[model samples]
Target: MSELGIEYQTVLGLPPVEFVHLAADLDCHHISMKVTGGGIYHHPAFSMLDDTALRQQFIAALRDRDVTISLGEGFVVRPAYELRDEAAALDVMAELGVTRVNTVTMDPDLPRSFDQFAIFTEMASDRGMTTTMEFAKSLTVTDLPTALQAVAHVGRPDFALLVDTMHAARSGNGPDDLLMLEPEWVGYIQLSDDTLAQRNPVYRDDSSDRRVPGAGEMPLVEMIAALPPVPVIGVEAPMRSLLAADTPVSECARQAVAGAREVLQAADELRETRARGCHR
Candidate 1:
């Protein structure tokens, strides 16, 4: 399945511990965990504040399954919001052996946002973690060029960019835009899709309307091919429609991973065919 990983939001509402098991069962080698939810930073259930016993259990489970906590998704960095206890979060990450944290910016002041991100990136780097900035059209750092600029401004080796397939499409970023990015600036790529209908109401529906890769109209094959070689693929299709229909999280994850695999397979085959044609 191209060793594609699953983002936590794909199976949102599943507790962190259970999510690990599901990722393992799905044969996913990597899992993204969220320490914050519903605008509340560090929800106890998933936060570092989670019971020590439970945290240990989670560690054991991860070790048993050989799954890595690839990325931690959290926050909208801005001057107005108080930064959470990053020390505590870093402690949790250390325990889990996580090396990357995802940051999204909502602040309109570019200078302020860049300054904040630089500090955040430095903090994460001090703790042996890399900070990946995720850009959405709805956010201040909207699109690949802007995101890359911010990362470059930060000028830290630990700073990188996260490109989500759905967000890239929504932001009008095409394969050409992705191709322009240097491979080193890309931390990872999130894979998901959505319908044209969902595009107009992205803010309202993005959380739940994302479709499995290859199930919607996104140019997933081209997007995947354009990304850096061997980039970690994160499946983030959070189909609330299925969840509302009482679809089990496991089933949703299975379908999401399967869809992503199909697209990757097709992309690979197409690349091989083109290479052969060129040689002939």
Candidate 2:
């Protein structure tokens, strides 16, 4: 069974220390966070990159809670922003024991997109870190095919691909698409669910309007069974309704984890059944 972790998007506004506390309380040892901020979420005044005192306090939080930053967020490769510009942040993440970083390339030029992302992977590997590139319909690395192309272009040992359930469903990528990947090339598998009432791909809406893992229509069990031993399962559901109702981030996290545990348990059973079938 895979361990449970929280994607920062599920509780986007929480700062590093508070986020760590939440993760500990919920028994999630791994995390994907927006450390660079970059105006992506509610960034606190305390700096994870600068401000040594704050950084130390944040580190202490992680130590006390026994939680680790599984993946560093906000390494977005945009037309205006380059991955090279994030060297300082990369150094900080490495210091904080973050070995894997994640990004989405929004640049339109495929060649440039491929090159810049590969360069980002090189930079990460230089700092004793590995990196994962995420694909989304709203971004230039739109689907599984384009994602694999970028991965091939990069062709680095440390580079890996991140596949989120919502993107796969919305972009029409299925379990077979994942089978094409070599196990080592696959990185974190983010878990999320879409409304059975309406299933469509609208980046803005789907960005936050996601249901908990077992609450909706996604094939969470099959999706997990398709992968070859992923490092972690990230619960990335951000319920806008719950947030709007002033629900505590902790409550949302608890709900997400509960649903995720059920989904992952079912996935384990499915994998077992498949193995038995093959033997038969």
Q: Which candidate number maximizes TM-score?
A: 2
Q: Which clashing pairs does model 1 show?
A: none
lDDT of 2 by residue, 21-80 (tens): 998898899888755442333445445666777688888998999998888888877786
Worst 10 residues of 2 by lDDT: 36-45
* Cα lDDT, all candidates: 0.78, 0.81
Candidate 2 structure lDDT: 0.81
Determine which window of 10 residues in candidate 1 has minimal summed lDDT: 36-45
Backbone clash pairs in model 2 (N, Cα, C under 3 Å; residues 3+ apart or in different chains), count: 0
lDDT, candidate 2, at 21: 93
Over 1-280, each residue of candidate 1 has an lDDT whose tens digit, in order, gives 3468899788766767777889989889898886544221222344445567767887888899889988877756876764454667666776788889888878888888888888777777777898888988778988777887898899987888888888888788988788777878888788888864444355745646678889898899988777776446889998877877878778989999999989888877767776799899
Model 1 has an lDDT value of 0.78
